[model samples]
Structure formats: structure tokens, C-alpha cells
Target: MSFPAFDAHHPPDKDLIDDCVHCGFCLPTCPTYVLFGEEMDSPRGRIYLMNKGLTEEPMNDQTVRHYDLCLGCMACVTACPSGVQYDKLIEATRGQVERRYERAPEDKAFREMIFQLFPYKKRLRLAAGPLRLYQRFGIGDKLRKSGVMSRIPARMRAMEALMPELQKEQKVPELTEPVGERRRRVGVLTGCVQQVFFSQVNSATVRVLAAEGCEVVAPKDQGCCGALSTHAGREEESLNFARKTIDTFEGLNLDNVVVNAAGCGSTMKEYGHLLRDDPEYAARAKAFSEKVRDVSEFIQEIGAVAERSPFAVTAAYHDACHLAHAQGIRKQPRQTLKQIPGMSVKEIREAEICCGSAGIYNMVEPEPAAELGERKANNILKTGAEMIVTSNPGCMLQIQASLKKMGHDGLPMAHPMEVLDASIRGESVETLLRR
Candidate 1:
């Protein structure tokens, strides 16, 4: 448990590193550690490097390499008994890297594009619609088979494999009324990728929120949560988006800012710090952050489900790393899944392990991401489940694409909110059932 003794070039907050007791309990859960079997890939070891970095210790190539390889999955944060706040450590280190280091031209361009486009909803929608053509035309299949992918740079190929086919999008209407009396008024975030990729998840989110006697606002003004940007250390752009978000929902008489996408929710919850430097929007940003809630947790808090009926479908609930670890929400989504009639929630092994879709990590680091996704898919398959339920759009794509590649693609992938809505509305989710 003895950590490396040295000062980083720029030390992080003393309180953060001091929380790590250097417990190696998180070693097995880390994707990089599991893959490379290197001490530096382990949580304790990373903390050591982070500590060293923050303490002003000199960085070697090895230190940078391991940090670069990190998915920032936060599985270690969940596994640590001492409650080491690895999420902050990793993010702080990443921000420092972005400020101080230089990446290759392609890496810089792609990462910049992700940060720029992802936080702006119009840009995302406009971009996604055309990309949909490439996906549906099976360009991915062509690339995989043509050896053209081999000729390209590894990182670019990695990006291509991460995208899944987008069916027609179904953006929610601006306002939706619940079936019964309104008990709460909330704003639902129509996330960037969720809108273009898993639009149905947003639909179900509105349906469930409505079914619970709440009025839902799918505000056209609420853009992305700046998640992909923030996670990649594009701090200024993320902060700008955060300001717009504050202005987006400023007037809503909201009980909460309900977020169905876990990664977005996690990012939103951290808006306090994301905009800390904004003189005009700092207070508003923090206020907006406090109002943010994961849809499942909001549902749980409002007693959205009165009872759980026994359903017979064997369903596996895949926990998105951001939801379970970064945001510290591990139970409500499961409860919602269990509420469906004739459904059985089955637990998968290594459920907390990253499916390798952290922000754009899958696209940027495709091989490892794919390996993790396939590993996750295999474990999910062993559950004998008829369907897999998850919260994040990225996780949905990663798992669904992996399952499809493995020929188990026929099995369904959906958000838990969808399941809850289907049960209450007695609506059959056939599209959800379809791969």
C-alpha cells in the first residue's frame, strides 16, 4: 500500500490524493490493469502516479502512457473500500495533460471536433443525420472486411468501429403531460447522442416521468451536458456549454433537471466546478447542477413505481460506469427494471467493468474498447437474459454493436426507463425488442 514518494509538477488538491489508502482492491476491476497486468494500470498505482504528478514529480513516458490508456471508467472508485475519489484524480490529471502536453495532429483535430460538436445539439443532430447514412450503408462492415481499415491509422479505425447504426430519430415534443395529476414538474435532458442514436430512451424517459404524475419538458434549448468535452479536458468549451445550459432551464418551475443519460447526468452534477470561473454564470451554473438528477433516482425519489410485479423476462441490467461509479447511483435503475411485469433482473459478472464507451474513448481507443465490449457481451450472454437494459447512449451502442458482431445481436438493448413506461402504459416495445 506504500505509494511512490515524490511531488508532481503540479500537485492536485491534497484532500483528494490523501483519500486513497493505496488499497489494491480495485486492481482486478480496472480494464487497463486487467488487460495489461501492469502495476501502473492498477488503481493504487495510478493514484501513486497522480500523487507524484500533483506533487510536482517529474513524469516519465511510462506515467503518461498509463494515464493515456485509462478509460477513466471509475470502476476502481466503486471497488475501493477506502472510498478513494479516483474520479477527481483522473479528471484533474487529464485536464493538466490537455493544458501542458501536445498530441499528434489527428488526435488533436478529432478530439477538438468531439468537444466542439458534441456540446452543441444542432451541430450534433446535423452531423448525426448524415453519419447515419455511412452506418446504414454498412461502411463499417466494408471497412472491417476490406483491409482498408488496416491501411488507415489504428486510432481512426478505432473511431469507426465505435459508431452503431442510427435508425430514424424520434425527438420528444417540447411538453408532455403525465396520465394523471401532476405531482412534480421536471426538465428532461435530450442528450446529444441519445437524441441521434437511442432516441427511444428519451421517449420512454418522458413517458415514465409523465406516467408518474409529472409534467415533462424536453426543452429544445437544453443542449448537451458537455460531457464528451469535459471528459476530454476541453474545459473552456465545456464551460461555455454549461452557461447555455443554465440559460436553457433557468425559468422552468422544475423539481429537478432529469437526465436519462448517465454520462450527461454525471457531467451536469459537476457543473458547479465546470463553470466556477464564469463570473456571471457561476451561481446559476451551480444552481443548475444541484437541480440535475438521473431519471432513475428522480423516479425513485418521487415513488414513481408503487409496486413491483413479477415479470418473466430474464433481463440483465448493465450499469453504465458514469451512473454507477462516477455519479454514485447504483440502485434506482435496477428497481425500475424490476418493476416491469413478467421481468426478472439478472446480474452480470464484472458488471462495473467499463464497456469501453467512455465519452469518445471507444472511437479513439477502439481495440481495447472492443475487447472490453466483447468481454461484457459474453458475460451478459451467460446471464440467459432475453434483454439487456442500460442508461447511457454510449453503453447502449457499445453493447449492442458487440452483441451484433458476436451474432447475439437479436437480443434487445434498452433503457430501464423504457421498460418502466412499457409496463405502465401496457405498450409493447417491439422496436426495443428488435436489434
Candidate 2:
């Protein structure tokens, strides 16, 4: 008895697969390809595997391993000259893999635990309670000092290392009035990990938007934008989250739906295609996607109106892969940062390479993720900047962990919104650095 490689639901599209011209342009930008120099790990190589799976090849451990190694950072989309839609191809391929391939018991359970925990805010917060205690009491440091970390599994250790210092949660109001005159009305997506762990980024985003003459609305009912699930190829889960998110902000009359996190914005902007099969949400999703904008992109579109006080710091700007490559938003962030008086934005080498924080890639594939993170950290150090500015929380944690490993842990990392908020609020450079 023979079986087909992919089930009947939605196999990777042959038309899309044929679009890959086997061009080597994606090699340098691919994180796994750059790290291992493996053809199967590069976008072109993976597209070949996907094509084989579509024909005679069956889905097996080897094929699945190659797919699993992909970070889904979409850097290839930016690098490709033929404009291949590798994002859609890989996403469809992963969905097929998740449905058809049987994994080892441990691997299956680990993936299940991640999906269960990371997408839900409440579960994450509950887990954070103990983690906060661990960080607060310095148990994490003590464990590191005692040299017991070596005994732990690499995945668990990666999770521990990526844990950012939890600060007191800063809540955003459901509605915030514009400072001077209302120029536009916008609804914000307060993301899952972003809200629980990096709430300050959301708060600062609201503040900056309001100060810039935008009446900001943060619907408390909004949940995960499904970037994690979407990237991981949990098709139904991601689409469900997408439908719920669309429903939450649908009735609110707004000029734009703003997002701060790079990953979230990229996923939210693709809701139309993600839900195109659904008759109910296909049209609604398209409308919603058009309004979705990265906060920096939105601000740049509207033009910054608020006065910027001097923030005297030379900061290296790390372009989060989702923002720069996935969304084609390379310049808006730097342009926004340059608006700050006395602020200099230095660019990192290999600006297109991912920092090993492609959603939960670091947590799942710890070794490769660490290699890329260290590589990114080395480039960042070469910039000689006082602080690091990026738009994604995952990048913040991954880069911080890598820098710590290199004994440069004191280097400050911040979101662009936080830096912009400090400049607008007239906060001292010292105060901003401490944050």
C-alpha cells in the first residue's frame, strides 16, 4: 500500500513552486544556509524538496527535517529577483508536514507545549508569574553561577536564556485622546508575548501615537495576531486567530490599524490571503489587511508632528527580519529614529540576515539559532554603538542573550517607540538609557 506525500486539503501549489528559478541569490540572506552551508536548508533547495514531495517523493524524516530547519524569516522574498512567493510556498508546505508527518514522541509533545503556551496571553502570564519570581529573587543568576546550567537540555536552556527581565506591567488605556488635535483614529493590536513580557513597548507606542495627534484605541478584547501559529504552519489555529482579530477591530471606525511588533504586523497584513478560502471573512480580511500598518510605517505615512527633544545616543539599529524583509519596511524605522535630535542611527552588517529569533525558532532549534545570534551580536559590536534599537521583542531577547554570552550584557536594548516616546516627552538621555 502506497500513500501520497501530502493529504488532499491544501498541498503546496505547483505554480508557486515552479516560480523558483533555482537562483542562488537567496543563499547569503538565508540564516540556516549561511550557518551550515547546506543546500537543502536554503530556500532554493527547500523549494526543490517541496517540488519532489509534490511528485514521487513521500514525506519522510529527511524531508521534514529540512522543512523544520526553516526559520520562515522571508528574507528570501526580499532577495529573490524573480519575485518568488516562498513565504506562501513554505507556509503551505509546513501545514502539509504538520498534518501528514509523524514525529518522535518527545518532538511532538514539545511542539504541542509551545503552541499551547505561547499563543495564549493568560497561560503565558501564569507561566510568567513563576518566571518573574525566579528572575526577581536572582535564582536564574545563582543557577548560572553554580554551573548547573550545563546539565539542562539545550532547548530548556535556550528558553531560560531568552527570558527578558520582566518589568511591572504597564497597562494601556482602552482609549487615549490625542495631545493637540486629532489627525487620525487608529486601533492597536496588543500582542500576546508582546503584551505580557514587553508591555512597555505597547504603552510607549500608544503614548507616541497620541502625542502625534492620533486618537489611539486599544481594544482590550484583541488577542494574538497569529504570527506564531501562522509562521509555524498551524493553519486553522492561525486563521481562527485572524478571524477573531478581524472581528474585534472591524466595527471600530479607524483610519488605520497600527502594530508595533514586526512579526505581528507582517502576519496581520496577510490576513486577506490567509483567509481567502473562507467566504465569510475573505472580503473582510482583505479590508482589514489594507489598514494594517507597522507603527513606524503608519507614523511615517502620517508624518511626525510632535517636537523631539534631544536624546544624545549613538544607537545601532537592528532590522527585525519580519519588518525589513517580510513587510518591505526597511527605511521607515530608521527615518523615524533619525527624527530624534542628537540621535545617530548606525546600521549593522548583514542587515538582511535574521537574528535567530524567527518567532520561536531559537526556542525550538537552539543550536542554529545560537550560531546566528552570535553572528548577529558580533556584527552589532562592530558598530560601536551605545545601545541597540529594534522593533521586535524576540530580536531584543535573542540579541541580548547572544551579547551576554559575549560578555557585553550591559549594552542597552530598546524599541523604536520607547526611544521616540523619550524624545517626545523631553526625558533626559540618562533616563532613557536606564530604561
Candidate 3:
């Protein structure tokens, strides 16, 4: 196939792109390629454009457009047999786009708004009240139905649709007293989105940690993990946010910095790498990163995790890509669940695949995201699990929405901690929600 001239605006590293062997392994698994039959949208083609863009050639609008459409989902990295390191490639490319590409002001504004509010927990919590008013008056519905978003660019349209639903005002309590024999002391990350939206999940995580014999310290000074900002290539903003988070948690002499949200966990665990340039914080960041753990990893490691799961329930488990593939944490969550005495954790087909919820992708790219979610929902349907367990709040919302659309009722999605809490208490799992 003939290639177009590359644009200088979105430069990828040449060495990384050269590593691609033109293997088709990444094609079948790409949600976009899997849904749409365009080779230009496939991993192989994206790499080709990246190679040209790296060499100072002017990349054509078509080439740049294709790259702009990428969701940066990292599936290509998982699928690439050649180890092309698409993570860095895509991240750098996005940075170049932000610096050199002339995106519409409206588009830039929308993208910046998320970074402005989402990484600041207090700001996000304060805005939730007004957002509820928008939802209550059906303003969002009217705007969406009016097709007003079409007047803007595709990227902006994607951003608008991803607007989060009305959220609750939930902030972490400074300290949660220990419940059982307190064997360990640890800190739990209060994520910006999870704090305001999935307040119950974070609360359940605190309860579970306490029941498992750990003093759960929810430091109000703790800042957002800045995963969303970093993923979007807002380097300066993300670095500041990361530094603040490190500063907040480092003061606590804790065994582990436990995070319930898989996305935040993945980012917090990489603090060492993020702050490597800092002479003072480098060692401290490494030490802190070492302490960082997903709630499942912490539970499995501590061995204080309970096993007397007296409730009988059928549930399907959805693995978060950030937890499983990004952090190499595949077993602990399932193991934690299987330990529950009476519950059966049914295996979901294609468990390794993402359920169309790579951080903010579902809200941003609703069409393709919904398509993949429906496919995942069908797979879950065969398992016939009454409830679904996923570690990340984003996946829970995306899957739950798909389940609702498919007319599955009362199968509210929950975190692994909720079940872990029940198992340790020797109470029915249903009590956590009902009570």
C-alpha cells in the first residue's frame, strides 16, 4: 500500500516505530479494527504513520486524523508480538499533537476541563451539586437529543458524550478506626472520580480493609493520582498532581498504600518512574511506589484475607486491563473471591479482553465502546451470574450500563472488596448492599 507524507505536528519516536515487524497479530484484537474493517485504523497502519511522523516529514491530514481517532487503549501493546512499546509511542504522539496540532479551541477547552477538575478531588466534589441540577432538568438529554454536538468536531462530540452522570458528594474520612485485630496499618487512595461518584465502593474498601485487620487511613490531604491527566499527555499538570499525592502519603509510615481503583493503582505503582528525575523525591517515590498496592494484591499478600463466605451467589468477574495486564495482577482478585466459602466465581469468556472501559474511553467513544460492551455483555450472559464483580469503577459503570440495556435486572456490579468484607464478617454478601 502507498503511504502518505507524514506531518511534523505529531512526532513519534523513530526507533520504537521501526521495531514493528508489520505483523498482523494486533489487528484482530483492536476494538476499532475488530469493529471497523479499515486497515488505516489498525495498529500496523498507526505504526506506519508514527514512523513517518518521527522522520520530520509532513504527515497528511488523513494520517493525522486516523491517529487522532486512537483511544490509546493499549490493546495494541498487549497484542504486538514484536514488543513495539506502543504505550510510549502513543503517549509521545499525543503530546506532540497537543503542542503542535491546531485543535479547535472548543475541543481543547473540553479536554482541559477534565484535567482541570478531575485531578482535584475537592473541586470535583464541589461541582457535583451543579452537575446534578443539569441531570435533573434533563438539559443533558435535550442537548444530546438535539444533535447539537454534531456542530463540533468528532473529538469534541466524543468528549461530550463521555460526560459523567450526576455524582454524589463523598469525601474520605480522615481516619477509619480499626474493626478487628489490627495487624497492619495502611493508606487507601481516595480517587477523584471514585470519591465523588462511586462513594460506596471506596467506603466498602475501607470497611473491608478494616475487617481484614488493617487500620485504614484515608488522608484528606491526599491528591488525585492524575492517571487521567497523564494518559491525556498533560505532563506538567500530571507531574504536579503526582508530586502532591506522593507528599501526602509519604508522611505516613505505612506498610502499603492500598488503592481500590485499578486505574489509580496502576499509576500510583509507577510513581518511582514518574519522579525519577527528582533527586530528593526519587528515592522517596520508589519507596512509596513499593508500598503502593491494589487492594487485592495487598489482601493476598497479607494472608489476613478471610475465607468464611457463607453467602451463596453466582457472579461473573470482569478483569480490569489496568489491573491484569498493566500491573500484572491477574490472580489475587480471583483468588480472593474463590476463597469465599459458598460463592462460585464463574469464569467469563474472553476475560483478558477489556469490556470497552479503558479509563474514560466509554464516555468519550460511546459508539465503539458500546459495541464492545454489548459483546462483553453477551459473554457474561452465558455465565448467568446474578451479579458482576470488577475491580475498577469505570468498568463497573460501563458493564452495568450494558447489562441494564440488555434488560438484566438487579445484578448491580460491585468491587472485590465488598465480597471480601462479607467473607471476613461471616455474613451474607447481600447484607453489604441491603444494609
Ranking by lDDT: 2, 1, 3
- TM for every model, in the order presented, reads 0.91, 0.98, 0.86
User: Global CA lDDT of candidate 2, please?
Assistant: 0.93
lDDT of 3 by residue, 178-271 (tens): 7767788999998887888788778878888887788888887677887877666666677788888888987788888999998888877877
**Where does candidate 2 have its weakest 10-residue lDDT segment?**
1-10
Query: Which segments of model 2 are wrong by more than 4 Å?
Result: 1-3
**Candidate 3 residue-wise lDDT at 413:** 70
Collision count of model 1? 16
lDDT of 1 at 45: 87
The lDDT for every candidate, in the order shown, is 0.79, 0.93, 0.75
Q: Give candidate 3's whole-model lDDT.
A: 0.75
Candidate 1: C-alpha RMSD after superposition: 3.4
Clashes of each: 16, 0, 5
